[model samples]
Target chain A: MTWTVIGTYATAICLLIGSAFVMVGTIGLVKLKDSMTRLHAPTKVGTVGVGAVLAASIIHNFTFGYGSYHEVLIMAFLFVTAPVSANFIAKVNIHERECDTPPKPTVDEHWATLKPNGIEKMPDQPAQPSNGG
Target chain B: MIDLFNLPVGDGPGATFLAWSVAISFAVVVISQILAMVRVAVGPGSGDRILALDTMVVNAIALIVLLGISQGTSIYFEASLIIAMLGFVSTVALARFILRGDIIE
Candidate 1:
């Protein structure tokens, strides 16, 4: 009985926090201007917002149903992929010339996204030794 | 807990609080979904649209989890998980298509 009460309140708190973060994140998504700036917002939703809700689910299940950790799988998968997708989106912005071009690399003639193909050697590739086959 | 569909008030303070929180969160998430939809519709660039769509997917996942909590069941877990995976894949693919003019190559 005690654990039930505790779990219920815990779940409620988690739900509230999660919902608040999700709301804030989405608000930022709508309100922020510029594609690069817009990219900053939804990541909040991806990480903390969904994370807290998943925590609530886990707690609620343990308290009132057959407890399971399967939700963790979703959480982990989201965590792993959110940044990768975000990076891809940013890359798209760069490739499309939608966002500010990054500062010139000190060591390379062109940013990777803007680099002309084949005309210049790839910056990261080492030059072959003259004697090597 | 008060079921949103059934509208029965729960028996105790904890249940009542949880139910109310769940209801409020549902409203908030739905509002976020609408906001994201607006962004998707009006976004100036494809990146913005893609980002908004990603946000929508994340919000959908949150909505499903809330549904699970309200119904007091674990069965929805699989649905949310599949959505998460698919959403991520779709976001990456869309971005890649924009970047490279191709998804696989």
Candidate 2:
């Protein structure tokens, strides 16, 4: 009984948080002034909203004894693929002349999106630790 | 929990809460879906429209998951899985075509 209650609360909270992220992403999708900025919205959905719902599903299934973990496959696939699609879409935006003047390159590698190579480039930021691999 | 809320026809403890939460989230997702459609119809550029469409696909997946939970069914899970695959492939193909004028290369 106690575990059931705990699961209920957990599921509710996860659903709330997940839905909130989805809402925010939707708002960002439509409201952001730039195409690049709009990309940020679904990226949030990709990470937070989807992850939360998957967590909720996992909890609900486990608590109700329906056999959990199938949600993980969807979650993992989304996590792997969202960034990929985001990258391709960003490339599309850049290729179609959607973004503004290319920002100055921070390192030896220039912004790959700006080049015709079309191999894709991760935006350089001071915060990200480059190349975990 | 249903009695605590003083509502009739409760399924179980926290049933009302879970249902209400799902209901509210459903509304939120619906709002987003509408917003995405508006963007699609009023796109300033094809790129923007494509992005909007991409977002819509993802939002649909989220809605399907929520629906599965509310309806207490597992079939929606397969729908979401298929959407995930289709959405990714379509987005990649469209974007690739836009970039290089050809999808197969």
Which candidate ranks first by DockQ, i.e. highest?
Answer: 1
DockQ of each: 0.65, 0.47
lDDT of 1 by residue, A77-133 (tens): 999998898898888788778877888799967777665334354445555333321
> What tier of docking accuracy does candidate 2 attain?
acceptable
- Stretches of candidate 2 exceeding 4 Å from the true structure: A103-133, B1-12
In model 1 chain B, which range of ten residues has the least summed lDDT? B1-10
- Please give the distance, in angstroms, between residue B36's alpha carbon in candidate 2 and its true position after superposition: 1.3
Instruction: Give the per-residue lDDT of model 2 (tens digit) for A30-104.
Output: 888888888887787777888898788778776665856888888898889987888888787876777876766
Per-residue lDDT over B2-60 for candidate 2, one digit per residue giving the tens place of the 0 to 100 score = 33323221366777787677778788888988998998998787778878888888888
Worst 10 residues of 2 chain A by lDDT: A112-121
Q: Which regions of candidate 1 deviate over 4 angstroms? A: A115-133, B1-3, B6-10
